[model samples]
Target: MSTSLQVGKILNNNNRITSGEIMGSSREGGGRGAEEDEFLLQIPEASAKVPKDAFHLAYIFYFTLGAGFLLPWNAFITAVDYFTYLYPEVSVDRVFAVTYMLVCLLFLLFIIGWAHKSSAYLRINIGLALFVLSLLIVPLTDLLYVKGTRGLYSGYYITVAAVALSGVADALVQGGVIGSAGELPKRYMQATVAGTAASGVLVSVMRIITKAIYPQTANGLRSSANLYFSVSIVVMVICLVCYNMADRLPVIQYYRDLKMQAMNEESKEKGPLSGSAWRSTLWDIVGRVKWFGFGIFLIYVVTLSIFPGYITEDVQSLLLKDWYPILLIAGYNVFDLVGKSLTAIYLVDNANVAVAACIARLLFYPLFLGCLHGPTFFRTEIPVTVLTCLLGLTNGYLTSVLMILAPKVVPLQCAETAGIVIVLFLILGLAVGSVVAWFWVI
Candidate 1:
């Protein structure tokens, strides 16, 4: 009889075989996985033992931290009416696009070059503090100018400065949070993306509630804006606290310890990555997955082209009136959240399929245009809403898949760089799409 069969027979006929015979048969059957496989033997020794509560808290912290990072940016984008109220003479859309892009690029380059060395916790704390200060700058300036004896036009300059500051904060928090999460498990990465979608939904809901609660008059709009930013500031503070607490969680610490151990081993083997070595490592990652990068770029380009720029500004409904944009944006946010969350169920594993799906998003341009200039029915509320939801869903799902897949494709040491590079492509796509959004007027 074969080793496994003999072992089974020996166990069944307990009195017939000696213990020594059973042990010999069991060792011989180890390869068959009959309670003696090497893989099974290794699992208990290798796996990290994490507390259940710590694992759960880490998820919440990661998700909330991701949302907190993007919340202020969403606040700026969603509050189109308030900003237009502040600067009627200027094209706030184009101004915001250019300024935010410029600031993100500048600050992102700094992080990749030098600030990446800093602990993510420190960077996140600074970013959160700056965000609170940026949010406070606008309302406080408006209060001083309107209630006190300050000049009238000064509010415009202050608002511009505040927006620019918010953009800077975005770069810091975004890079730190994403880079830190990338070093953890894939689910944490998913949590971060889901959090981003949730932030958009949260801000959309906040705008809807505030708009309903307050009147449409200038003073009422100002009050609404104040309440929205105030709530956002509170959320940011909570995220900062939660992030620190998460660092102390058993599950998070386990991952951090493993990462450090691997990093140390790598340094000993390769003698710390010199500047050229780092460049070479990044270049190898690029060469291996250039298509993946392109797919991510396209995903963001198409997404940025439609969202906020188009959904917030171009689409309109006579019945819903001003509520049209708000509701549409909320729909997009909701679907996007669902799409990101769905990855927990099933993610597309094939790279070709994911890339092809991304390229298909080019269809969104023509489809959205049809909504703008097609037959009257195409321009109606239902079609626009459906297309907007599809747009958000695809954007959320594809971006999450690409971000999650890119790092795993790379070597362990290159994983962090892969995530950061993917983000850089994402930002590039946003900048390009924002510029393209201007052509909608033509």
Candidate 2:
């Protein structure tokens, strides 16, 4: 049941998102012209005093949730070698990707439609539970059933089902977490977004560590795969505990009460958020944030198309031939973390420039193509490495910028919906990008 006071982060329109705190009475240009602003509005504090984040616990909780939600996909795909080794007939990685993305996109669509009727707290808890369940399936099944055997088609299907379950969990947690963060100040949003990049870096670093430590034999592969899911399960449990505790924090509750006050005032006048009224409001919020959503969409479409596919398959180095793609991926992830963190330092509040930068990312195509087709110098490791770093940097920063900016421009009441709608666009972009990667490079 929905709590009278919210159990997760939420948003209301306010001009007060500066330096990243959730509560304030002031608001920026909340109308259509918000898009035309010259710079982010001045700090303009609200009439009421803002409460502190209280030891940054709320901040840490949001960041952990962001990282936790993405870990399932990372765990599954990172352990791809074992899945393939166990069942050689099928393409394990591609199958898992298709199933997971499809399920996530579909569930996210359902969540967006019924967002007003549901609560972020319920969705997130259930999602986190599902994630733990999905992670357990892998290590447990391998231990009890597979027993280091090969050509186990039954085990393969079960693993794919777990991937699909994780996708459902992702759909539940990701939008709610981002939407929840949207209701708070900008720093929490920054933390949440940055944690996503941190997840990639964490997985990459762990993969490297496991590669260095483990033998290349079948037994070694099984052990490494088990480690990935075991560690992921521990993180998900931490996320669940941290997430439940978030709403109880003084800092988080302060903003929840603030948003509740606005909601109560609106409901008293409008006589509850009726279905038609909510649908109309949702459409308006969608209109307000569509351009920002487009920017997010383009960002993922570009990043995913080039990332694992181009880096993993198209390029090679004489010295780092086998390690080339691994190093390139690690570099991309570290720089992506750097880019997401940059937003906390200085956010580009102008919507026009943010969208334009996303469009500018189209240049990545030719530059990356040059790595394959252009002169030796352009096609070499240095150029590819530089371009890949640029790709991750642009992808991380622009995604963080758009995700943070979109809902803040909406009515305070509709901000959470706006954030979820933005996620709909993001998941769609990811799904499309995955498809495009399959057919890319002629």
Best by TM-score: 2
| Residue 96 displacement (Å), model 1 | 1.6
Candidate 1 lDDT by residue in tens digits, 343-439: 8668886889999999999998888889988999999999999999998899889888877776666544455656666666777788788787777
What TM-score do all the candidates reach, one by one? Answer: 0.86, 0.89
| Residue 282 Cα positional deviation in candidate 2, in Å, after optimal superposition | 1.0
Candidate 2 structure quality by residue, lDDT tens digits, 304-377: 78878788778889988767887898899999989999998788989999999999999999888888999999
lDDT of 2 at 265: 54
Q: What RMSD does model 1 have? A: 9.7
lDDT of 2: 0.81
Worst lDDT run of 10 residues, candidate 2, spans 1-10
